[model samples]
Target: MRRILYAIAGTLSLITGLIGVVLPVLPTTPFLLLSAWCFARSNKRLHAWLINHKYFGPAINDWEKHKGIKASNKKRAYVLIVLSFSISIYVVPLTWVKVLLLFMCIALLWNMKRIKTL
Candidate 1:
C-alpha cells in the first residue's frame, strides 16, 4: 500500500513537472525532484530512468551529488523566472493579483539565491 501510494505520487509529480516545462507559473525542478524521491522509494526502475533522463537527469544528479544546481542552469532559471513573472505581472489586470505575483516572484528568487551553485 505504501509502495502503491509512492508510485501514484511519483507519477503525478512527473506529470506536473512536465506541465511546468510549458507553464512558467508552475515549477519544474522541485516537482521533478519530488517525483524522483517518490520513485526511489517505490520503484527502482522509475528512479533509474528519471536519473538518466536527458534534460532533467543532470540537474537531479547534481543536486543529489553536490546538493546544488549548476551555475548555468541556475542563471537560466533566474532569467526564466524573471521574464515569465514579468510578463504575467504585466498582463494581469488586478492590482492585488499583480502584487501577489510580485511577492511570489521575489520569494522564488530568494529561494533560488539560497541554493548553492555548483
Candidate 2:
C-alpha cells in the first residue's frame, strides 16, 4: 500500500507541476521536485524519466545544484502572477475572496523574491 500511495502522490504532484506551467502562484519546480521524490520512493523508472525529462530536467538540475529559479522563468512567473491576480480580482464578487487572492499574490511575490534569481 505504501508503494501505491507513493505512486498516487507522484501522479498528483506531476499533475500539479503541469498546471503550474499556466498558474503563476503554483510553482512548477516545487511540484516537480515532490513528484521526483515520490517517484523515487515508488518507481525507479519514473524517477529516472523525470530526472531526464527535457523541459523539466534543467529546472530540477538547477534546483539541485544551485538552489535557484532561472531569471527567464521568474520573468514569466511575474507576468502570470499579475494577470492571474488581476483576473481573479476582477471576476470575484466576494470581498473576502478578493482579499484572500490579494494575500496570495503578495505571498507569491515574496516567495519569488526569496528564491535566488539565476
Candidate 3:
C-alpha cells in the first residue's frame, strides 16, 4: 500500500519535472529530486534508472554534491519569472491575487539569488 503510493507520487513528480523542462516558471530540480526519493522508496529499478539518467542524472548529482544550479539556467529563470509574473498580473482581475503573485515573485527571486551558481 505504501509502495503503491510512493510509485504514484514518483510518477507524478516525473511528469511535473518533464513539464518544467519547457515551462521556465516551473523549477525542475526540486521535482526531479523528489521523484528520485519517491522512486527509491517504491521501485528500485526506477530509482536506479533516474539516478543513472544521462542529462538529469548529472544535474541531480551536481545538486546533491554542490547545492548549485548552472548560471545559464539561473539567467533564463530570471527572464521567465519576470515574463510570467508580468503577464499573469495583467490578465488577473483580482487585486489580492495580483498582490499574492507579486509576493511570490519576490520570494522566488530571493530563492534564486540564494542558490549557489555553478
Candidate 4:
C-alpha cells in the first residue's frame, strides 16, 4: 500500500513537472524533486530513469549532490517567473485573482531566493 501510494505520487508529480515546462505558474523543479523522491521510495527503475533523463537529470543530480541550483538555471527561472506573472497579472480580469497571483509570485520568488545558488 505504501509503495503503491508512492508510485502514484511519483507519477502525478512527474506529470505535473512536465506540464510545468509550459505553464509558468506551476514549478518544475520542486515537482521533479518530489517525483524523484517518491520514485526512489517506490520504484528503483523509475527513479533511475528520471535521474538519467536528459533535461531533468542534471537539476536533480545537482540538488542531490550540492543541495543547490546552478546560477544560470536560477536566473532563467527568475526571468520566466517574472515574465509569466507579469503577463498573467496584466491579462487577468479579476482583481482578486491578480492579487492572489501577486502573492504567489512573491512567495515563489522568496522561496527561490532562499535556495542556495551554485
Candidate 5:
C-alpha cells in the first residue's frame, strides 16, 4: 500500500512536471523534486531514470547538492511569475483573490531570488 501510494504520487508529480514545462505559470523543480522523492521510495528504476533524465537531472542534482537553481532558470521563473500574475489579475473575477495571488507570487519570487543560483 505504501508503494502504491508512492507510485501514484510519483505519477502525479511527473504529470505536473510535464505541465510545468509547457505552462510557465506552474513550477517544474518542485514537482520534479516530489517525483524524485516518490520514486526513491517506490522504485529504484524510476529513481534512476529521474536522476539520469537529460533535461531535469542536472537541475535536480544541483538542487539536491547545493539547494540552488541555475541563473537562467531563475530568470525564466521570474518572467513566468510576472506574466502569470498579470494574466490572473485581469482574468480572475475576485479582486481579493487576485491580490492574494499577487502577494503569494511576490513572496515566492522573493524567496527564489534569495536562493544562491549559478
Candidate 6:
C-alpha cells in the first residue's frame, strides 16, 4: 500500500514536472524533486533513473547534495517572477492585496536568490 501510494505520487509529480516545462505557472524543480523522493520510496529502478536522467539529473543531484538551484534555473525563475508580478499588478484591483502579493513575491525572490545556485 505504501509502495502503491509512492508510485502514484511519483507518476503525478513526473506529469506535473513535464507540464511545468511549458507552463510558467507550474514549477518544474519542486515537482521533479517530489518525483525523485516518491520514486526512492517506491522503486529503486525509478529512483536511479530519475537521479541519473540526462536533462534533469544534474539539477536534481545538485539540489539533493547542496539544496541549490542552477544558474540557468535562477535566470528562468527571475523571468517568471517578473511576469507573475506584472500579471498580478494588472489583474488584481485591491491595493492592499496587491501590496501583500508584492511583498510575498519579494520574499520568495530573496529566498531563491540566497540559495546557492550554480
**How many angstroms is residue 66 displaced in model 2 relative to the true structure, after the best TM-score fit?**
2.0
lDDT of 3 at 75: 94
Per-residue alpha-carbon lDDT of candidate 1 for residues 1-118, written as tens digits (9 for 90 to 100)? 9999999999999999999999878889999999999999999999999999999899999988899999999999999999999999999999999999999999999999999999
- RMSD in angstroms, all models? 0.9, 2.4, 2.4, 1.4, 1.8, 1.9
Against the hidden true structure, what lDDT does model 1 obtain? 0.96
Compare the candidates by lDDT and give the number of the best one: 1
- Winner on TM-score between 1 and 6 is 1
Candidate 2 wrong stretches, greater than 4 Å: 1-4, 19-27
* Clashes by residue pair, model 1: none
Per-residue lDDT over 1-118 for candidate 5, one digit per residue giving the tens place of the 0 to 100 score: 9998999999899999999988877778899999998998999899889989999999888887888889998898888888888888889999899899889889988998899987
Q: Please identify model 6 stretches exceeding 4 Å from their true place.
A: none
Across 21-97, the per-residue lDDT of candidate 2 in tens digits comes to 88665768789998988998999899889989999988777776788889998898788788989998999999999
The residue-by-residue lDDT of candidate 6 on 1-118, one tens digit each, is 9999999999999999999989876788889999998999999898899999999899889988888888988998888987888798779999998989889889979988899977
Candidate 4 Cα RMSD after full superposition onto the native fold (Å): 1.4
Model 4 residue pairs with clashes: none
Q: What shift in Å separates residue 95 of candidate 1 from its native position after superposition? A: 1.3
Over 4 Å off, model 4: none
Q: For all candidates, what are the clash counts?
A: 0, 0, 0, 0, 0, 0
Report residue 86 deviation for candidate 5 (angstroms).
Answer: 1.3
Candidate 3 lDDT, tens digit per residue, 1-118?
Answer: 9999999999999999989989866878789998988998999899888888987897776676788988887898788888999998889999999999999999989999999999
Off by over 4 Å in 3: 1-4, 21-27
lDDT for each candidate structure = 0.96, 0.88, 0.88, 0.95, 0.89, 0.89
Worst 10 residues of 3 by lDDT: 58-67
TM-score between candidate 4 and the true structure: 0.91
Model 3 Cα displacement at 30 (Å)? 2.5
The residue ranges of model 1 lying beyond 4 angstroms of the native Cα positions read none
